[model samples]
Target chain A: MSAQDLDGGSDAEADGSGEMPKPHTIRLELADEPGQLLAALAPISDNGGNLLSIFHERGNLTPRGHIPVEVDLECPPDRFERIVDALRDAGVNVIRAGAEHFGEEVMVILVGDTVDSDLSDTLHRIESSADATLQDLSLSAREGTDEASSARLRLAVRSGRVDETLAVVRDLAAEKGLHVVEPLAEGSQ
Target chain B: MSLRLAVLGAGAVGGSVLDLAGDYGHDVVAFADSSSSAVDPAGLDPSAVHDRKERDGVVGDADPESVFDADYDVLVEATPTTLGDAEPGFSHVERALADDRHVVLANKGPVAERYADLRALEAESEGTVQFEAAVGGAIPILSTISDLGAPHVTAARGVLNGTANFILSRMAAEGLDYEHVLAEAQDLGVAEADPTFDVDGIDAALKFVILANVLSDGETEYALDDAEVEGIRNVPGTALDLAAEDGRTVRLIGEATADGVRVAPRLIPQGSALSVTGTQNIVQLETKHAGQLNISGRGAGGPETATAVLSDVSRLE
Candidate 1:
């Protein structure tokens, strides 16, 4: 993970004057090489983009055995497309690139008969109803599926949508007689 | 100034108040359990009262109703918390206020459940009401809010219940189940024999409801029924394990704003101010001018809570 410099410089002439530099997130898949992250980040800075943060998921891997990296940068509307094209042009596999997508991650634990309640269906409902993406899940039912079980879910939600997502989760859990332990809002701690 | 005090309820808080009132330069003129009372115009001996209560199960030979007849300046209400109507505690406070006497409460029921009625009674009389012990014990939460001005304080939140926090912290620390940790807490006397009030989030909810009532400043009244509460009973060890993996831990946190109160097991970053382990408690106040203020201390205990009650007594003119 790279340090997030929220003050991403005042150099905003990449896409001409009178246009504000909007934040954009780009996801890339890299091989397990020494310079893979450095190589992947080069195209972002080379395309006149100001780097904001680099979330390097070293412990996590793509299905094809590649490291996943999420880079947040500030660029004008037209320049964001150019940065994505330049990354692919430089042979960096750009998996996802967008401005109005996942901006924050929230984790919650749901405890109940998750297995018998059709956990997959519950996940689908959460994703659709909450406008969130199922990022990861870890279910523990050591007492067997017949008994109470707990599942920890990591959901990728758009920024400022955490409260809405949690309300949806609480409603769904209530319907199934499940309990949801939500993460406290950022900075409230 | 030395003032005469009539303490209600002979529980831990009331007993400690009787024992320590002399040290604080006050006199317990009257003391009562539910059944009996002890009154001396000057001051009763604390040890003698304790011995009589221990041996005969009565604080004194006087009738419980006779406590009101004693010449006391402050009424210390430390009865067990009751919900809904808040019981005889409310009636005791009402009687004290009607006599133009100050009331210092260690009981949460009257404050949390019947805030409007209590304040109305206070408004009708010349006396004032201060209930610092009703919130975070010995943490001076209410006094700090008073110093900062309740309007300047935006919100209040923390691990208010020590018993629930003890169970959660022990579960996270030893990777034990909730029942196992709760049993250990019971054996250690950190939790009561019937842990429903503590573990089910009622105790914490009541405290936060009191905070909410205070923060509202008589604009909006809050009660235990208004709080959205969730206990720590359903939180498994695996959930804590997962939170620990991400540099976080689960705490039975409660929040109170002018809007309302909420108590639940939420994930907070490990080592944060709110992540107090064992039977420790912490309170975070969101203020308008001061950014954020964190006050941590023993939230509940005989001596610890007596300090709050005594401090409230001293604040009264």
Candidate 2:
């Protein structure tokens, strides 16, 4: 893809109009052979998909002795289907293909009785209400669940939704009597 | 350009002003410490007043109210800060302005809690209020805003509280709990015996509230109640550990914009400009054309704050 296409993707997203490019992840199983990886990737760029990343599982093999690969690419909503169809038409085993458009990562620490407040339910509510996905979470309950503990949450949110997502987290934390140490806003540093 | 001064309050800041006024070519004509006053038309000796205050808990035999009647060109309100009506501090400024005399304030109460009232009094009198010492002790935050013309400055944010910063930085560096670091800070004299105003973010919030008032330039008025303040009291050591693991550290940062003011414990990058260590303070001003200007130094202390108060007195001259 041309450099203009990549810039065009972000520009379209910035203006919040037209058919913006959406990031999608594809899981594929390729045979352990020379050019198998290159052959699988050719269909994506050929169908106007901008390659974001390629997670080549060289040592990871499927039950059938095939290498499992995960590819992240960005393209318009309509072109995404064509890219996936082209991959399948090339005789590549498409394990899964779906859109996951998280463009920003926000880190926050919630301090309180995180466990006693039903953390799973809190996480579920954040995901559904804030339109964010819980990417990673590290809980430190050294003082036991009975005492106050801190949980570091790394959330993946849509671009420009950091403030809205944080507001939701703040509301949730307030309800649970937890304190949230939010990161400085983007570009503030 | 020497000026006659009347200093109110005999606390650290007030006493420092009285001690350093002569060095700045100004004479202390009147000095008070709530209960007593020392007044002389020809100016009073700084050391004599200090000695009297040290020996007998009082500055002089004169009544505190008599300070207003002294023949001074500027009144320095260095009293302890109070919330709401801002009490005697607010009254002191009013009396100074009513006398058509300039007033320099090192008190946050009158400015943070009664900005509009102070401005109205300034408008009705020949005197003008300059409170560079009220916000960041020695950082010159308000003066910088004044120099840039408040309209050109959009926002101000920084580590405004030394006590809170000392406690947080100590906790982060030593991996100690909040209580432990706070006790250590008290021992080091970085934090006061009752640090609720600092640790609970009230002190920082008051500074940011003053900043918001300056940035608004009378278009808006911000008081302490208008700020959304959150303290570092709830920030456990594990929270700092978690932030450190991710290449970040926590600080009690206060932000003031035309929109509003908010002071809270925020996670900033470890080596960023806002991550000031110990009792140091930093103020970042976002100007309309100047990008961002950072002014950092000791945000609190007797002599450091007195310098700010003296600078205000010089401006009055």
Candidate 3:
């Protein structure tokens, strides 16, 4: 998983790095089909991730016409990073990942030419580099064109790691010439 | 292979159902009661299914919790009746249905009261709500006659309440009056402390409502207050004497008529199926295309009703 490439996939095979249990969560979308769920599970299970529980809503349809699945799994500390990397390589959307110890709750918004700029790349950068979790997302492509559409991402990030998350979002928006709309911090609020 | 099992409400019917469903190699989930006496034994093993006092899969610690919110594919509603008190017992069933869980209910009072609401909910969730034990005790009435559009049953009636019919049957056979027969039934625990629903036509009337709603493909609304009810309160010499001329016996017939459903005595044919339905027994179902379909068997005992429910549960897959 490169810190630069945005399409998330880094490899295609199980170079098993394994995982240790941590309290991290990720949200993802996949095409609805028989093997999609199994493919998603592979990244966690093959990497030595301990499955706590899985909430598979087969009936609830996601935006991509797929079922929404929430999996809570445990991974070992030693192989956690490699497990995440393997997940990215397998083309499993590593929407969010962290070694159970990192990440806390945070809310942020960026203003810019979101549609014109590659917003998907920006989100991937934050996850791969900033140690934050995208908890929930609300997007408005109201301007309709890909160049001007904007999206709001609600994230669960490592506690005290909000600055790192914001830094990535800020830098990406600046590079794409998009505006940033962020929340108030310590004294500002 | 083996599976998990649980029995909620360890009363007469629940006890019986647990015994039967457990017979097949399923590990008992736990025996549960409203008060739940078996909460201390952690992880009640599957072997407990055979314990005469033990029930598998109830709401206690030693038992598997009936977590209505969690993902369990099946539920069986076997509870005693509370004619109008629509809480925990029957309402627990409502929760099960809401979660889209499969259900087989032996309890009739709740269906009599909440069938329409539950049916709509099931339809919305795309789940199944079956009640084979509601009306005809051990009789397979619900499955036998489910053509709610009336192509199957243009008109139908039943000798529904077996307990009441049993009491009436004894009076006709022994040539006794109401007091002696009532005393005999009470000693046998056939009637309840408040005998209004069973005798005053409320019980049979509610069954009447269930039949009418299912047969008409309508809703569950018992304008029961409007129904003309005539319970056997006293024995009259002329009534007993009427038997001499009619050559026919008396029985409680819950009839769904053209104008409205009614429960009363009608002179049935001498060798009619319903007339031969005997003590604590039932025979009543008629289909238009299929003609008359008579189902007769023990209609009121707990074990029989339990077997009725478990039979449906086993056949679900």
- TM-score of each model, in listed order: 0.81, 0.82, 0.54
Residue B97, model 1: Cα distance from true site in angstroms: 0.8
Candidate 1 backbone collisions, by pair: none
**Predicted candidate 3 versus true structure: per-residue lDDT over A4-93, tens digit per residue:** 232212211233343323444445556677788778878777877777766564444543455555566665555555666776688766
lDDT of 1 by residue, A34-77 (tens): 98788788888888889998867555566567776767788776
Task: Pick out the ten consecutive residues of candidate 1 chain B with the lowest summed lDDT.
Answer: B237-246
Q: Per-residue lDDT tens digits of candidate 2, residues B1-317?
A: 98999999999999999889889999999999989999999989989999998999899999999899988999999999999999989999999999999999999999899999999999999998999999889888888888899999888999999999999998889988888888888899888899999999999999999899888888889999999999999888888888898899999999998679999999999989999999999999998998999999999999999999999888876
Candidate 3 TM-score to native? 0.54
Which is superior by TM-score, 2 or 3?
2
Candidates in descending lDDT order = 2, 1, 3
After TM-score superposition, the amount by which residue B44's alpha carbon in candidate 2 deviates from its true location, in angstroms, is 1.3
- The sequence of per-residue lDDT tens digits that candidate 3 reaches over residues B1-317 is 44343456667787676666656544334456665534212324433533534444433444334445333455667766656543455666667667666677776666666656666767776447667777777877766666434446654466777667766777667756556666777778887666767776677777676666667666335545435554544322223334323344456667654445766543343345666434555545556555566667777777888777766676565
Candidate 3, residue B103: the lDDT equals: 73
Clash pairs of candidate 2? none
Docking quality band of candidate 2, CAPRI definitions:
acceptable
Chain B TM-score in each of the candidates: 0.99, 0.99, 0.82
